[model samples]
Target: MSTQVLSPPVAAVRLEQVTKRYGSGPAAVTALRGIDLALPRGAFTAVMGPSGSGKSTFLHCAAGLDQPTSGSVWLGDTDISRLKPRALTVFRRDHVGFVFQAYNLLPALSVEQNITLPLLLAGRGADPGWLDFVTGAVGLADLRGRRPSELSGGQQQRVAIARALVTRPDAVFADEPTGALDSRTGRQVLELLRRTAEELGQTVVMVTHDPIAASYADRVLFLADGAFVGHLDRPSAQQVADHMTHLGEW
Candidate 1:
């Protein structure tokens, strides 16, 4: 293990024997195959896998967006697999946040409104201090009045990130967060995500295919056939590429 792996995480997320499948018997395809992994608190972690590696399945399970076929997915102390629908929504709203390749901001809402929309839907109020911190942290203070259409792709993604951070949830799950941006813009977003974990003690788990994106993570996990094949820590893009090449996926 690298020293990065030995370093204590500020917050921790765990999965035990997590598996997911569709259909039944010969028709059933196992998306995840009893994979177990831990995401340390306040750590920026990225996941990478080839086209059909079950990476998306793992992300959905981690965020409680989809139920695993068996096993447990634990966010902090909450075993998300067991929550009822209503309870699950409440739990996710209060403890988990998300970002994706799509910005997913409402077209009609201003940046501020979009960022706080989740809290409003939960019937909860935002913490004023945390709001200030998130907007400032994402450098979106001046753009809060604008709608998604008025902003660039990078800015729209920043809003999505701000919304994800606004709740100050225990962990944030980002799937292909920078996939739509140009390389330079992607780097900016990656840097901001890292800053959120490092400066504010936010825990982040991101799923990405781009080696440059994974390099920003404190640690990186590689998936193959719905299982964790290996991991890299404090990696450079070149290093990840080299490893991926050897893994027969590059």
Candidate 2:
């Protein structure tokens, strides 16, 4: 009998020579400039850039929230760039997780209901074990029956984080996830996000202008003029701030 071997999982996200344009001909505004990026499974990356530097555009394109004008995007070898609108919607629902600054939970729903909304929307039954695990992990075990209105900002964001992780998607895209919180509460959310990547084997890509927020990531990728300019590993807030200072008016 022959022995069989299995290869490591594919990259959680990959971008190849991707570009985005807002218009055509002379009126065109380019957002991404032939960008190539690969984010490994279970890793956490933060993207930072000055205003108008295409930080949001990069996150949108990479996470399948928006399409690029040229080049390809792959979520684990599936060419999401080529997916039709409806197919893309389904694919994103199944494979991608999102955490936004707004904490978009339903006021009428309890914490547990809000967290399981994605799975419900996808018409899938929640796994009891996974639900319990995520709720506990995010420190919401005791608040499952409470509504979002009853929680503190930090706790509400914790609910959002739990919701994002409930599906175990291939990657989570966070857009200024801490922008709306106070410093202490924001730090708590960031710590939970870091724990998600480090402990749960999930991949995350976040976009933020704050160096303190970027400091939570395993790697920091700096973008300027819609292109990758530099990167740092295990970065400090001071170092990230210094790099941004050199980039001018972010």
Candidate 3:
């Protein structure tokens, strides 16, 4: 009799013994300390930490926005940390999506233009059907002709989310995506993010300090003093808050 062995699912993003340090003298600050993480494809993960706990560093490194002083960052089968600036820029543009708190949109562009900017920059044409689906998914089909100035804050953010999904990238990195919105608006945006991962099979990594925001993710990883301290799976808001409260003890 023979038994079959199953292979583990490949990680969408992986970091192996990653470390980052600023400056080079005695005053140099270590932003990350030997981080070893593997983000599964089609899952949503949230990162949380106290101020100066290296949450930003982790995101930057993982997203290829910054390089690690020592170690490797893998985006699928590619090692992004080794790529040169120009190559890395092109690679990132083609494979990754970003959602930021500021809702960085070109005020002069129509909603459709803003959402399709990535594809245009890449010198590619948007697929009409995919564009239609994306606009419909974000509830912006009717507003596609409008500019950013004509939209509410929440509406602008919905546009940003739509733009992030326009590329059909392997992963989306969100940096405090709900910080600029009111609680209700924030919740709505969070729900949209969660739905994207659930329905479209997009991998998402978000950085947030709010437990309510973290609760929307499938898993929450806590960082402290440049290192990972703990994590919670399928966490509740209260549970996330409690874990954060004792992060120092871990």
Measured by lDDT, the strongest candidate is 3
- Which candidate has the highest TM-score of all? 3
lDDT tens string, model 1, 1-250? 6565564543368899999999998999998999888777899999998889899999999999999999998988789899998999899988898998999999999999999999999888888888887898998989889989999999999999999888778899999999999989999999999999999889999999889899999999998888888999999999888777765542
What lDDT does the true structure give each of the candidates? 0.90, 0.93, 0.94
TM-score of 1: 0.94
lDDT of 3 by residue, 153-221 (tens): 999999998898888887899999999999999999999899898998889999999999999999999
Candidate 2 ranges with C-alpha deviation above 4 Å = 1-9
Candidate 1 C-alpha error for residue 123, in Å: 1.3
- Please give the RMSD to the true structure for each candidate, in Å: 4.7, 2.0, 1.5
lDDT tens digits, residue span 148-240, model 2: 989999999899888888888889999999999999999999998899999998999999999999999999999999999899998999999
- TM-score for all models, in order of appearance: 0.94, 0.95, 0.96
Off by over 4 Å in 1: 1-11
Better of 2 and 3 by lDDT: 3
Backbone clashes (count) for model 2: 0
